[model samples]
Target: MPERTSYDAVIVGGGHNGLVAAAYLARAGRSVLVLERLDHTGGAAVSTRAFAGVDARLSRYSYLVSLLPPKIVRDLGLRFAVRKRTVSSYTPAVRAGRPTGLLVGGGEARTRESFAELTGSEREFAAWQGFYGTTRRLAERVFPTLTEPLPTRAALRAAVDDDATWHALFERPLGELVEETFTDDLVRGVVLTDALIGTFAAAHDPSLRQNRCFLYHVIGGGTGDWDVPLGGMGALTDALAEAARGAGAEIVTDCAVTGLATDGRAAEVTCARGTIGARRVLVNASPRELAHLLGEDPPPPAEGAQLKVNMLLTRLPRLRDSRVDPREAFAGTFHVAEGYGQLERSYQQAASGELPAAPPSEIYCHSLTDPSILGADLVRRGYQTLTLFGLHAPARLFTADNDATRERLLAATLAELDTHLAEPLADCLARDADGRPCIEAKSPLDLDAELGLPGGNIFHRELAFPYADPEDGQGGGAPARWGVATGHPNVLLCGAGAVRGGGVSGIPGHNAAMAVLEEG
Candidate 1:
């Protein structure tokens, strides 16, 4: 082992959150260094020249960037490095044996106005306004504080009470909130889809506060629907890396960490290159990622993490309608629930720890809207980039005899797309790393075992409490004792795998830094 080089802080994994933590800590006058497993920074939020001659977002994994505290970005001076663009989602009705754009310019205003126009109750619009206000306020109040350590008891209580969070946020599932607010199926559907983006919950599941929590996450730059990072999700990470360096944080990439050496007061990170020591060590990768680095000494988060199956496609999936809102049309986020029941069934199947026979696939295409990349040629080449996401299911489902479940899932997704699109996708389909088809998918269960995620569940801990668990009571709050942090005293935790569920939001990293600062 090389001589132990010491620093104020050492962050493992150059993912966005880790970078965020390092930037914040360095700004606070702490000497910091970051180690990344990949050759480049930006763990999941990376763009690579892996696909074509062009550098498109490689994974777009955990797709979309929302709920990231803008204050953090500004504070770190990350504005110049990152770019953002909004993508709209379109769901055309297969009416009259053809697909019809739901929003037709003037038609949108009419539809929006008419629904709320009648009965003196603009329920949908009013609900949307109120919900956005609530979430926005919540983000402002909660996100900024996450950058600091967990507040004192009085501070926590006062903050929660002052924000009226107890009344509005306590134990509420986002689905129920949406249903109560809107009478229309489509509006509720959009919100539900957003809530369940990277989660394992069903849209109608009662314990879906995490889904509600995800609202703040998906509400990235701008409004109305989710936003994708400009130039693909990779740009966001690049900006973070730049900001971290600007803050005097050193970054080393392609150096995978093998284990952690700690003496209770400080942490020594053992990577392929050598061992680097720091007063504090923050792990920005998923819990499993951390476990891989720490080996068996420091246990991974109790809650399991999921495996991600990423696909960089040559063409876009064909949607049923044309002339849809180009923004919504190009927007990659999709709510696959044909109706509420389908969503429930899918969740039920997932809970039984089995991949759903007809898994609901949330699809997105970032390359469609981003202008700098290849969109038209992808179409001309008979393809457009697409990603299909589903909940984490049982590992045995993949290994079971006959593999009936896997085949069913494979058939269901393509068959459902056929129901919505004009032509079959068989021709546009190409090869992938999975070899089964485009990309053979992996569930959270498989990810936990393979990637070293502890619980076979994503998020270091549950984001939405009240619904998260009654027995443990480790839900809600930015900082809690005995959770989300690295079990080791000096080692810290970050990433979506941190507490409060997963997404591209940098809260975990921000909070982890605050925790270290507070401890010091």
Candidate 2:
């Protein structure tokens, strides 16, 4: 139970963001209550032993950590950390019936060589240097603002201070930018994967939705490095929950918030257990769920356009490209059939409600970087974990038969991956004690039913630009100072749906707490 009829603030969810808010608010001495639907916290940022009788603990969903501000870590005194991968990404390819790939991040010189080797010229490599250099600069300018008050579009633009870079990143379609910058289809696809990770949009979408997704991916930590949390994703959330509790926040699990009512100044949260009141309400859920809680009609349902598959492998799979070692290639993001043409073709197919013949996906071997996630015995026996993310597999495709589509898509996606592998992934798969392959695939619908993600959209909905559009209002409205405000005076959004939110970042949670503190 909440242990109080009323509190200074009530959080509707106990995901990472919710825990972040609770930690911050409670540390500030505010009476805060966190209500979680799941029996545990962490939400999507959780690690579990998925396979029966398996000792390897895998980051089940939302595997990587980026955009989690250092300020939040220090402020909450969370006992957590992340390790960067030596190689950024490796995209395997087959050209002229010969195996090849582009490997990013082994120092600039090596990356340049890889690009040159793939494109047969230094032209693409030079362009790559310039493109990422600009994004690094933009990230430096834009990332710090996420934790602060909402900046007007002009203010952020002024801070960015380069019209050409600004126009390319914020104004035009990311797809167009990619086409103009890179000539190689594989290189272009590798660059655009960041933009379409969880987003379903074409490169030339006039809405510039892809641009927003691109910015989020690149601006993380001002360096855009997606680090692996040391103990898997759950380590961060576990630390967050502990920090929240240590600061005196009350967290009640298995207590679902059934309804909510607010009068702008005070609010009441009705849950599976009982109703509790608070002077302020902070919702760490999707906008759709928040609207329903407020008794308002939610906007059109958000849809997730990705497939997640987790596997415990007996050993790393050998690659078709003999130039690269399996340990080095698997340590970073491994791109599969994600060439520029392939991505567009897949998106077009999925948009028309059909699976692509060759699905584009990326794989990460977490145990390669941090073997602590696996049991000591498993580690000694050459075990590893593969966390795969298949792009452009939207929720709509599963509307008819979720399980069948998931299985079909998984099979197709893996088959595509095998095209660049010396061996089928199944051959490397470890079997559970029960003699079952330690593999599980999740579709958008499965995520929705299990995680309550609106249409399984990870960002909750379309991500808004970190900066507020000047036409929208002054500084995103006086009330929306931290991009966490709602129509109600006492209610705020502190979830992935918040402006400048999403990722494993606690920016929204920190902002929501700051908003409450400032109001008082």
Candidate 3:
């Protein structure tokens, strides 16, 4: 028989969120144990040498640091660092047989000029500023509430104090809001892209889940800026894991939890290795996964709609428009075939079980922003890494055949990219030791199989608004005000499936710790 142990709290899964919760709980003098199934931690927020025999350390899954709260970093004393991108985003366009594009975030003057050039109207630029200005105000009001107890919707609305901002973001369709605000097709697509990232829905979908997803993406850290991690994503999770260990948390990898049972006094967790009893249990797995462990029906399946591609490039590809330097354009988000109409058609195609001929995707060159991801030898060889995120490729399309669909999608995506490039993107290939080009594509099914992501949904499931629903009232045996509550009092969610729990942010973990401490 396996030995059984006891702890103040036990956290399942060793993802960044679980580590964060362990750090906070252990720091509070509670004996905590974190169990991870994988040999390694970090979960999706990991960096690896993806290409065999290549020295480039690519952020294999989750990249960038935007949603991580500064309070968590400061309180935990994490040593991670993130650098801001000099160039925000660049979208390729053509006018009069001349290479032209819209560039944002380099300079105020440059952004204004690019917007005017793209739209042929200064009014559109002004409207763009006005629209974001509203979002900025909304972010300011909402971001602070994330770490605190969930506020009632009425209370949050009062805090926002702007009916127009509330209606535009929460009540109205994001597609309608973007289309009404921005005139340029590219500009509109750029804004709408945030709503669709990792979410499988059209901007106009009445479910309003996309609105919640967009809110989290934009309100992250209150600036909505997706900054590059200095030493790749691993640095961030490593710091969190170290902090948890320093706080006296017992972290056990290669130990997978198989079942969880909770009584009024204590919770018991049975894992592959042994059974452990705790005063409380914190789950860092997705809601669906949690339900399976509890022998309950899972929530509605989540369907992810994105394709991830990682590549090591011999050199940056030349752009069709010679006026813009490749380095500057690739420094930030490089939009490819993401015009408004193109995005709509891509979604339509994918929804109909066909890969879009012209897929909407975005690429960013990490080395251009932070060369630390590449080894000294690779850097000297002028090699860089490109991360591509293709949108509108839903998981359902790949259900029949993942390999064939992935290849077709990748081929179509690269071909579409060639349209805007002076040379074929494949021409700038860097070969691995085996002489194969350093390129890898992961479809939604691939993500599901590799990352244990249900339906490959990165956020775990549809995002929930941070604020409490007013209609829920104080009835129906509602769990608690912390948003980490579950049907079982001792089993709290500390992962992306919790309310306000998406992204790389440790908000859910922090809140879960707070919940346990408060209950005691």
Candidate 4:
């Protein structure tokens, strides 16, 4: 017979969310046990030495930080730090022998000059400021409410205090909104990319899932800025795990939870090693995974649409536009083949089961922002790390022939990158001890197989509005009262699948803890 341990609460999964929940519960003087399937914790928010014979630690999956709430960071007393990127985004648009690019957030004069070069007018730049100003206002109001009980649609709209902002973001299609606001196709694509990241949907998809994704991306801590972790993403999770352990939480790795059952008074979690019982069980897995563990019919699997590529470059690639600095261009998100028409064409192709001719992707140089990711030797050698997220490559595209499709998509993506660079990106790649280029590509299928993300969806399932939408009846029954409610009373969701639980944020974990503590 397996040994049984009793705790006040049990958290299944040791992802960032699980760790967050464990910390909060244990800190509250409740005995907690966190079970993880993997040999190591952190889930996707982890760092590893991907290249052989290289001492560089790369944030293999889920690289940047933005959505993590400040309150949780402070409340948990986490010691990790995040560094802001100087350049927001740089897009190269070389036209007829004229080398020019759109640079946002670098300098006021430079940004206006870039906009003027691209659109032949300064009005578009004014429009850009106006649009982002509105988002900033919306973020300020909505972001603070994430950690609290879910608000009704009317309450949230009233808080925003701008009818146009509410209608444009909540009711209208994001694509239509972007088109109406921005004049340049590239500018529109940049704004719309937020809606499509990790989500497989067109800008105008009536489902409005894109809008939710967009809102989350832009509302990070009310500033909508994504920052680089000081010591890779692992550092952040390590701090979280430490906080949990310090609070007397027991975290067990390589302990895959096989089954979960609740009997009103206590919840039983059966794992490979043993069974644990607790008054409350917080599920930190995807909704689909939770259903499977509970022996219930799983919901439709969420499909992840982005292809992630990690590459180590011996040196930054030279850009065709000689005016812009390569270091600055690659520092932030380097948009590649992400024009409005380009994105639409790619989406249509992927939807039809065909690979996009030019996969819309963006690349960020992590080492440029945070050199701590590299070893002294690697840094001295002028090596840098590049993480590319390819949008519109959904799970279905890889179902038939994952390897073949991955290779095709990668080649297409690289070819697209080569268009803007003076040299092929592959040529700047660092070599491993085995002479293999220090590069790897992961498809949606790979994410599912490796990280246990169902259908490789990073956000777990399709993202729903964080607040309860009663008019649409979207939020799973009684969402406005508590978004983390699992309807089982004893079980609660504390993962990305929960309401307001997408991104690297620990809102779900914090909310779940609140639910448990409130009941007591």
Among these predictions, the greatest TM-score belongs to 2
Cα deviation of 190, candidate 1, in Å: 3.1
Encode model 2's per-residue lDDT on 88-158: one tens digit a residue.
99999887889999999889899988988888999998998899999999999999999999887899999
TM per model?
0.76, 0.98, 0.97, 0.97
**Per-residue accuracy of model 1 over 1-520 as CA lDDT, tens digit each:** 5534889898887888899888888888899989887678876566544443333344444556655667776787776333343334444444446565333123446445533433235666667657767766555455544444444445644554544544434446666666677776655655565555445666545665445546445434424235556666677778888888998898988787888878767778888767777888887766556666667544424443222444445555456665443335545455454344565676687678666655665566656655444445554664455666654343445545324654566567657656766567665555543344454455544555433344444454456431123334334333344234555677767676554436666777777777766666
Off by over 4 Å in 3: 1-4, 470-479
Q: Give residue 456's lDDT in candidate 2 (0 to 100).
A: 84
Better of 1 and 2 by lDDT: 2
* lDDT tens digits by residue: candidate 3, 1-520: 6444999999999899999999999999999999999998898888999988998999989888888889999999999989999998999977777778888877889899988877788987898788888888888888899988888888888888999888988898899899888777888888888888888777898999879889988887887889999899988889999999999998889988999877756888999767788999999998888888888989889988899999999999999988788999999999988888888888888888888889989999889989999999999999999999999999999999899989999999999889899999899999999999999999888988887788999888878877887442212222367788776778888998888887889888998898888877
What value does the lDDT take at residue 107 in candidate 4?
80
Ranked candidates, highest lDDT first: 2, 4, 3, 1
What's the lDDT for residue 469 in model 3? 72
Q: In candidate 2, which residue ranges exceed 4 Å CA deviation?
A: 470-479
Candidate 1 global CA lDDT score: 0.58
Which is the winner by lDDT between candidate 2 and candidate 3? 2
Q: Whole-model lDDT, candidate 4?
A: 0.89
Could you say which candidate leads in lDDT?
A: 2
How many residue pairs clash per model?
A: 20, 0, 0, 0
Query: Model 2: how far is 424 from its true place, Å?
Result: 1.2
